[model samples]
Target: MAELYELSMLLGDLEEQLVTCMRCGMCQAVCPLYAETGRETDVARGKIVLLEHLSRELLKEPEAVKQRLENCLLCGSCAAACPSGVKVLDLFLKARAIINGYLGLPPAKKAVFRQIMTRPALFNRLISIASRFQGVFTRPAGEILGASCARFESALLQDRHFMPLARIPWHAKMPETDEPAGPDKTKVAFYPGCLVDKVFPDVAKSSFKALRHHGVKIYMPANQACCGIPALSSGDRKAFMQMVRCNLELFADKDFQYLLTPCATCTATIKEIWPMMGQYFPPEEQEKITALAAKTMDITQFIADKYVLQRKYDDSVDKGGVKVTYHDPCHLKKSLNVHVQPRTLIRVNPAYTFVEMDEADRCCGMGGSFGLQHYDLSKKVGNRKRQNIYQSGAEVVSTACPACMLQLIDLLSQSHAGIRVKHAVQIYAQGLG
Candidate 1:
């Protein structure tokens, strides 16, 4: 009872944003989870109502409210579709921190987020060791996608086709560099978010290849921290801030025109979420964060905006090339409005014919930890995306986010779809050859 009072008090801080939701039901039209379950509690308006009730002490079941909140994908669909222009994602994230502050996090999450993730070196070492022994417990599930499944039935693995960690992480291959820009070239810092570093090192390689092809200088720093979205979404503000501070320190002195990342999620987190959550930091720290966020750009966005010539080409021009479709990650499309840049990158590649997939901007259902906690719901949402990809009749599917690549690969591979998955940068880089 006392804890509930304290939680409500904490939630009181968001009362202004909470009341912004007019319950217009605009969120329903775009919510992927609500579309699957048709449950009121799964939608933004429903969740907002619950938070309001909890804040007012009109609700008694904190556990039930917490469960309903955790069931969300945090894909920003509701916030994007809101006619009221409510800051739905910001309100929900802050409410989550308030609720979890009173309820407390699970032991496992505490150890992982606070202990392992906050320390980049330890986290990298652990993932490296796990990569070496992963072959023992997992077997190849999809040949073309390079996905794996558990050798024996396991609760965690559970017949899911997942991309395995790279044998050698990207940083190990190119630990750090301070390459100078060529004549009339721009210098940019490269950030390979956790997934890109550990699971899809090729994306990092392709990003480098593409940047070099354009005569852009590179300045990759050592010991880059996780973007902290995982920790923040899990309601661990402490861990999230730790990561932000670590990254701020690393890039504080580096001289670069822009900060670029191959991962859409990382780009959004740095450019949007970092500034949104910067209120917790000191004034000087907030200024640094704001500056960094301003300079952060998605790799595809950087290439398309600065280099690619925007001109419409007839589909017949590239008819002989492999047909490729783009999937707009929720973070890239909804949060950052980056839907067009990645497509531009794909369209510029003469070796690939770009096809428009139905609902290309829809969420691929990998909401960071959301998929891990709600695999059944996640798969239900992802199956829809897979169906759209199949209908496109494309030989390859490309996206800007590595996490989306993970989800798309799983969905397409599990259904035995022959379509290959590649990052837009990868497709663009291949064309440079």
Candidate 2:
């Protein structure tokens, strides 16, 4: 009971943001989960009201509130569409931390987030071992997508087609680099996010290829930690802070004009979430985070801004190329306002014809761990995206986020759609050839 009181007080700190929700139901129009579930509790307005009641100590069941909050995709659709401009993501994230801090995280997550994920070396070593033995338990599900399914029925693997861990992760291939910036060229610190590093190292390689083609210098540090979104979203604030501090120590005082990443989630987490959570750290540590966040940029954003948008391309160079469509990542589009830059990167690729998919900015339904927990709902939301992609009649589908790529690969592969999934930077990199 005392703990509940503490939780309520902690949640009370977010009351100002909670009151901003006008209950206009505008969030319903954009929320992918609500669209499928058709439940008020699935939308941001209902969640905000629940948080409000809990903060006031009027709600007795903190568990129920936490469940309702976890049901959300945290795609930022609600916050993006809110007329009152409420910070929905911020409110939910903080509320989650408060409640979970009181109730305690689940055993499995507590172990993974606190034990394995927080330690970069151990995390890498374990994943590397898993990669070697994955074939014993999983079988190839799709050739084009390079996805695998469990050989036998497994609760965790389920019926989803997942990208197998890379045989040689990006870090293993090229642990670190400190290439100098050429005359009149920009120098960037490259961060290959977990998925890109382990599952899709080619994306990292392609991004590096694109950077080199554009005369950009590179600096990548070893022993880099996860961006901490996984921990933060799971309500493990301690683990999240540990990861942030780890990354801060790595990139601090490094000479780079911008921090670059191929994964949209990494870019958004660094540029937005890191700063939002910086308040928990000391003043000096906060300054380092703020400076690093300012320097972060999505690889697509950097290339498009520095090169593609500035140079006029000859449209007639390649008329009959692969028909490619773009799926905008929620973080890149809503969180960072980076929709234009990724599309610009695609349009400049002469080897691919840029075709627009219906609702190109619709959420892909991955939502990080949200997909793992509520995969039935995740697949339903993702099916809508699949229909749009199929209807586009494009031979290839591309996105800036590796997480979205994983979701797209699973959805498209389940239906036997032969469409290839590539990062925008990968497509742009092909043009360099």
Candidate 3:
């Protein structure tokens, strides 16, 4: 077991950063978890106070503090809304790392993060095999939503409607590629995050279509590792850093003008969190992170900014455009300030009508593994998003993040809302005719 003194050393680095919090209660208005629980301890302000106390030895139970820290959705809502510009997510993440270091990770999470997640090839192979048998345990819950629930009685999957893994994952489809720049003379290294690679390969295919349509060259290396967000968010810094180094080793020497992904979480992780967490690394690794972060872009942002400029926005709604509503993924909109570009892609398609849902920017509550840890709370947050979607009265709903897409599909499927969920890239790619 790790010692408190060790945790203090780790958390000492966060004290100066934590002192910047003003406790103005602005975070309360935006924090999804706080809104649901109505507990001060659930919000950033409360967490900051607790961190301050723990750091000074005022709080005896580091376990209690650890629980509070893990309760967060990490959706960047409070951080986005903070008036004093508090690095709330950064602080919480570092603090979680401190607490988790001392307290240790749960056995299950330790196995997943350390054994399965860090080993990319083994992880993919296992998931590929597991994907074949998942259908045996789960029966279709919603055809339109593409979701499944446990076939029989089971405590683990009680009533969850989840998107099964793709029968053929993205990597299996296009194992590797190194296409030179097309007429546009632009090359990109594509990073399909885990969810997109194993669960939503269509998004990857769509991204490839959009890229090829615009004459962007592709450098998609096979057996790409996880984005390290899962390990980082789980407070497994060792695993997180290992995964990061794995990716850097793969992508560092690649010649590409941009690193792109359809997954909003992947985009935000690479763009914002990578640079933010690079401080503890060596100078060379830090420089590599900075360079990579500079070139990373969400696929939608890349398309709207670079490709759409060359062509006119299609205004051909006369073709009886499909009524589609957009869900602003918290990672894309709040973390990276990428709000308009996704909608712009929908509008440019001319095959879809972009409808704005109520509280479109609110979190879908699929904080990667958060949903698995606290299903009831996750469902409560997700239900709010479902209500907003149903109220929008759109036939189809789209979001940029695969995780958000998973949550929406689950919520809508369980509610029997009969709405189709899709990634924004899939919608745009289908319209690329």
Candidate 4:
């Protein structure tokens, strides 16, 4: 049984933050999962109430309470629209830490986060093996989408279709770089995150082209760890802390005006969530986090804001270009409020006609580790996004998150659809030369 005092102390910490929530229920309107299930428990307000109950000692099962809290997308919708200015994501993350402190993460995630992700070398090797053996387990599901499904039933591999790991993750191809700021301009560090470095190396390569085109010097580091969003969301703070420390150490000495990432999750996590959880760090480390958080920027924001995009398009130019639509990742849009710049980058690419997908800002159901904990629900949520993607009638789909890329590819492929996936930078970088 969880002690009253310990739970009480956690409740004490949550007290002020909880009071900010006025129960306005605005979160219900935009929540994708709540829209599908129509379950109050699925919405942010209901989850907040359940958490309040635990704080007051009314809710008994910490496990049950934890389960309800875990059901959320952490998309920041509630926080975004909130009038009373409640930090819902903050509360959820803290509550996760408290609950995990009491009950601990499950064995499998513990292994994955603590063992695999915390160690960069081992994680790379493990993914390398998984990439090699992928065909033995998965079969083609979407030709146009290039998605695949599990060959056999398994807990981890359900009916979801997904992009198989790249044959050579970007790390193996281009381990690292340290180029000086061009004679004309500024320097920036780039953290591609795991998915981009591995599955979506094209995204990284394309981003490099775009950044360099802007005359932004690149400082790509080697032996980088996962951003730890997957681990932290699963309530594994130890692993998450390890990842932050690892990245902090690698980039600490480098003198750069900005640190950037193509992945929305990494941008959001490092900029927002990292400092939110900085209470656990030492005084000096906490300062380092503050500096890092202040400096990190999404690639689109960096490009659109730092430099003027070069455009040489006429209505008739590249009329035969690929048709593409964009999806706004929850982290990129709701978390960091970076909705338009990516699309602007799309607009800059005259080679591809930028088509607007239905509900372009909707979540694609790849909520970090939320998919792992709830695959069926994740796919169901992703289903709406797939319809929106198809309904747009575009031949290609683009998004900023590699996690979303995997999810979209899976859903698009599952329907046996033919939709190519591209990063916004990939589209824009092509027009540079």
Q: Rank the candidates by TM-score, best first.
A: 1, 2, 3, 4
What lDDT does the true structure give each of the candidates?
A: 0.89, 0.89, 0.87, 0.83
TM-scores, in order shown? 0.96, 0.96, 0.95, 0.93
What TM-score does prediction 2 earn? Answer: 0.96
| Candidate 4 segments whose C-alpha is farther than 4 A from its true place | 1-10, 55-59, 309-320
Encode model 4's per-residue lDDT on 182-252: one tens digit a residue. 78659999999998988888888889889877777888888899888888887787899999999999897
**On a 0 to 100 scale, what is the lDDT of residue 342 in model 3?**
85
Q: Which pairs clash (backbone N, Cα, C closer than 3 Å) in model 2?
A: none
Local error of candidate 1 at residue 263 (angstroms): 0.8
Model 2 poorest ten-residue lDDT run: 309-318
Off by over 4 Å in 1: 1-10, 56-59, 316-318
Worst 10 residues of 1 by lDDT: 53-62
Question: Which has the better TM-score: candidate 1, or candidate 4?
Answer: 1
In model 2, how large is the Cα lDDT of residue 279? Answer: 74
lDDT of 2 by residue, 1-433 (tens): 9666655566666886777777899998999999999999999998887877775433477787778889988899999999999988888888888878877999999999989988899999999999999999999997988899999999877999999999999999986899887898689999999999999999999998998888889999988999999999989988999998888888988889999998899999999898988877899999999999999999988888878755544544446889888999999999999987887788777778877899999999999999999999999999999999999888999999999999999999999999999999888888888
By summed lDDT, which 10 consecutive residues of candidate 3 come out lowest?
310-319
Distance from true location, Cα of 336 in model 3, Å: 0.8
Off by over 4 Å in 3: 1-6, 56-59, 310-319
lDDT tens readout by residue for model 3, 194-219: 99999999999999999888888899
Which candidate leads the pack in TM-score?
1
